[model samples]
Target: MIKFLLIVNRQGQLRLRKYFEEKVVTHGEQREIIRQCLSAVDKQNFLVEFKDFTVVYKKYGNLYFIAGITSNENELAVLELMHHMVETLDKYFDRVSEIDILYSLDRVHMVIDEMVVNGYILETSQPRILVPLQLLDVARK
Candidate 1:
């Protein structure tokens, strides 16, 4: 099972975070995790083992998509999930960037929520996943 997903910039600023489990982490622990993630990605490592979880991360421009999963989870599948997420965002934002994500965080979270629920992938089809968001856009206009 996946524990959490984090989007962090190169400078170690967190752009987004979503926790699938109900575990509570202290602020210091959260910061330490982010630091470890930054270092892991900087070394060009795709997978890193933590205390009780494994981190799978991919770099896109200056942003890093990181997923923390149980030790038994498949790293490649999580990697593909991150790639699909980036692709979906690219399609929606027309060349997605950090700024785009910062500005439309709600939409971004909605997209992530549509794809994942309770640490499990709910949908892989981008069009089907985006339909509700598109409808929301139309309604807002």
Candidate 2:
């Protein structure tokens, strides 16, 4: 499975680190899906590779983290949508002090955890729970 760990800094820059498993398990157009997913984020390309379809990162910066099990056959739209959502969140949360966000509640999906000290933003450390894209759409129903 392919795992993506995306992080955001106080500078509003996004960094994505892909976890390559070194053994391709889900094969048959994996790159194509990734391409489309990148496009959905308004990005032309992604620095991603796979091995066994697994990508693991212990952590990143003082702001974010995620973990997921993705197969070659996983829907492109889903991956793209998730990434898009992450981008959107980063844009709006300019002054977040801390947040614990889960990518998906359905399976053993990704987790995004951040800690923004008052020194970083202000004397305000309001915690928030950012919902997964799937759930964000669901409650609107």
**C-alpha lDDT of residue 35 in model 1:** 83
Q: Name the best candidate (by lDDT).
A: 1
TM-score of each: 0.93, 0.27
Residue 21 Cα positional deviation in candidate 2, in Å, after optimal superposition = 11
State the lDDT of candidate 1 residue by residue for 38-111, as single tens digits: 77635657887767888788889999898889877889999999999999999999999999999999999999
- Consecutive 10-residue window with the lowest summed lDDT within model 1: 23-32
Off by over 4 Å in 2: 1-4, 8-43, 54-69, 72-75, 95-141
How big is the positional error of residue 28 in model 1, measured in Å on the Cα after superposition? Answer: 1.9
lDDT of 1: 0.87
lDDT per residue (tens digit) for residues 71-99 in model 2: 54244433453454344455444432234
lDDT of 2: 0.35
Q: Which sections of candidate 1 miss by over 4 Å?
A: 41-44
TM match of model 2 to true structure = 0.27
